[model samples]
Target: MFNMILRVTENPVRRTTARDIAIIAVFAAITAALGLLPAIYLPVSPVPITAQTFGVILAGAVVGGRRAGASQLLFLALVALGLPLLAGGRGGIGVFVSPTVGFLIAFPTVAGLIGWATERVGAPYRLLPGLVVNTAFGIGVMYLFGWVGMMATTHLAPWAAIVALAPFLIGDALKVVIATLTAKGVHASYPGLLRSRTARAVAGAA
Candidate 1:
């Protein structure tokens, strides 16, 4: 029974389909577009508040884990290739080494984590569970990585660095709520867009 439970819960590895690639590419572009939104810079921290994280949340919630991560990775790859795809029109190799680098590094990772959690919440994406997963992964996990990145790059004390990031919490919280609602709508309309691996398997068997 225990083994059966594990099997039922497991996310089976599957090959990416062409449709997955198209969705990934579209989300990557959406991420870039969100970067074009005006960034609000705070005096306390070097990182600016932008709508990009909103894109990150949407990518993970709308698409499944692997594809969402791939989309974020693809967006970062474009940024690295000298496109000005970041907030305030910043990009290229230098941006990767900049103070915001840690947050940038967290992009793909957080998206993947968010997708994984969203999948665990299963289909129909309930409001509470969806919000909880998005908050935990999108804000909590993302901030952790960004905090570490800032300390390593700027040589700031840990407490001071995290303190500096306090201003971003409010905006990010709003993003979480908005993204969760948006995802819920998408899941309702599409129904099959964000299904868990187990859910997909069950559907196939049916």
Candidate 2:
């Protein structure tokens, strides 16, 4: 009976088209929900510290590069439509014009990059390695867009722009560490939960 149950649990027959859609939708909703968490306002800047970093990293780790990027793009689209879905319930096209806008635009690309990198690592998960890669790539993406956006939108000189961004750097690094650990934990617990595409390919072959 134990062997039979194991066979049933591992049955490839469980894979289905609807299942893939449902899984992706669920992860997308999770990403959005993480965005809605309360934020810590920074008096120095309009940018607020929020759990959205978790959402961003989770997208890459759980959904892989392509769907992860798609999920972030969907979230951005919602924001563009004037939904108060961003940090501190702020959103709209106007937000895109703000100094923090570059960070917003970098979200999808960072997710894709992290996802792609993690996939290349080819392991269950290693916290230090994941943390290092994610911290570098995620922060690099944010700063690249953020500095340019700040320079374009605000009166701050280059040094001031660097100063404005400096305060958030440590916090962002902490978030990256948290995200890396979270991803590793989820991966260990649910080995194949994120394999919707792979399952589909196998199902097609069968």
RMSD vs true structure, all candidates: 10.0, 10.2
In model 2, the runs with Cα more than 4 Å from the true position are: 1-24, 40-48, 193-206
Q: Across residues 1-206, which tens digit of lDDT does each residue of candidate 1 receive?
A: 85885577456546876588789989999999998988877675565678998888888888978989999999999999999988778788998887668888888998898888887777767889888889998998899988998898899999989787777887798789988999888888888776556866688689
Error of 2 at 93 (Å): 1.5
Q: Candidate 2 residues 1-206, lDDT tens each? A: 85885566454544445455455556656766877877776666566678876788777876677667767877788789888877677788999888888888888888888878777664556788688778777787878888888988997898999988987876687688888888988889878634334555577679
On the 0 to 100 scale, the lDDT of residue 197 in model 2 is 48
lDDT at residue 21 of model 2 (Cα atoms): 47
* Model 1 TM-score (2 dp): 0.82
lDDT of 1: 0.85
